[model samples]
Target: MDVLLVEDDKWLGQAIEIGLTERDFQITWVRSGAAAIGELQRQEYQLLILDLGLPDIDGQRVLQSVRRKQLALPVMILTARDETDQVVQALDSGADDYVTKPFDLNELAARLRALYRRRGGHASAEIQVGSLRLNVNSHEVWVADDPVRLSRREFDLLQLLVSQQRRVFSREQLERQLHHDETPLESNALEVHIHNLRKKLKHKDWIETIRGIGYRFSCD
Candidate 1:
């Protein structure tokens, strides 16, 4: 998953970037509120970490602007302020969660996972489809009683499809969610991943190709 981190503190920003990267999350760090807003507008991110004490524009304004535009991006406020009013205001302004600094990186990671799962409409960390079970936290997949190994992209693709089973996802939507980079993916990149996933599952019928419409995790 990709995250937009808005923090003016260089040390904290670097620490967060390093920590999240270690956990398979792509982080884009911006030091100012304006820069953060620009990045948010130009790119797609799974979550946003906004600090209320920005050097340029106030982080509250940035959050308000995002809500005003109805971006629907999950935001978690990471700041030094622990005031009750501040927390309430942020929440009312559409922030999904709040974490006051100085905070534990592990807890932050867990919170991010929860936010992502919630956004994906998953009620739990584990998703079960037929005999296949996927543990979102451990990045583990099991088919029946045997474990299955999947590449990072392949796992992400499967998770997306299974989380919203039977919903047709366009190639563009899959590409954007899986690949955070702005560069265009190769024409066969998605196809290759899908083929590999099917081969790994050993169940071709698990994922159904929708002819011209892309792919679906067929629950039928």
Candidate 2:
């Protein structure tokens, strides 16, 4: 999933960016609230991780602005403030969840996944379409009861396509979701991933390319 991380602490930000990227998350890290807002306006993200201590604008104010603008983006507050009132305030301000500074990266990723699942209207981590099954939390995929091994990028691409079956995702959208901002992508990287996924799944028609448009998941 594509996530926007707003943090000012260099060490913490780097740690999160690296850790989440390793976990198959496309992370766009920004140090200031203004940059975060700008990115939010310019691109699409599945989730947002905001830190209250920003050098420019207050994180809470950013959340408030997003809500005021009626952006339904899921937000999780990552801050040092652990008080009950602060947590409540952030939630009331449109933050979906709150995590304190000294937190486990695994737990943070899990929370983000939960938020993403809920936003997608999925109550569970496992998503099943026809004979194909995917467990988002476990990072597993199965076709006709046979376990399928997939690279991280391949799994991400399949998960996205299956989760919103029939919806055509443009090549650019697929590329953005598969890679982060700083990563240099080859011209045919997406095609390579798609080809590999089809081979691994043993079904070429499972993912349909729309010629000039994009690709869509189809079991029919």
Q: Which candidate is the best by lDDT?
A: 2
* Model 2 misplaced regions, further than 4 Å: 124-220
Clashes of 1: 0
User: Mind giving the per-residue lDDT tens digits that candidate 2 earns over 1-220?
Assistant: 9999999999999999999999999999999989998998899888999999799999999999878774678899999999999999999989999999899999999999989888767778888999999999889999999999998889999988997899999999999878965778899999999999999999999999999989999997
Instruction: Find the number of clashing residue pairs for candidate 2.
Output: 0
Give the count of colliding residue pairs in each prediction: 0, 0
Q: Residue 160 lDDT in model 2?
A: 88
lDDT for model 2 comes to 0.92
Per-candidate TM-score against the hidden true structure: 0.56, 0.56
Q: Ten residues in a row with the worst lDDT in model 2?
A: 65-74
Q: Evaluate model 2: give its TM-score.
A: 0.56
lDDT of each: 0.90, 0.92
Per-residue error at 85 for model 2, in Å? 0.8
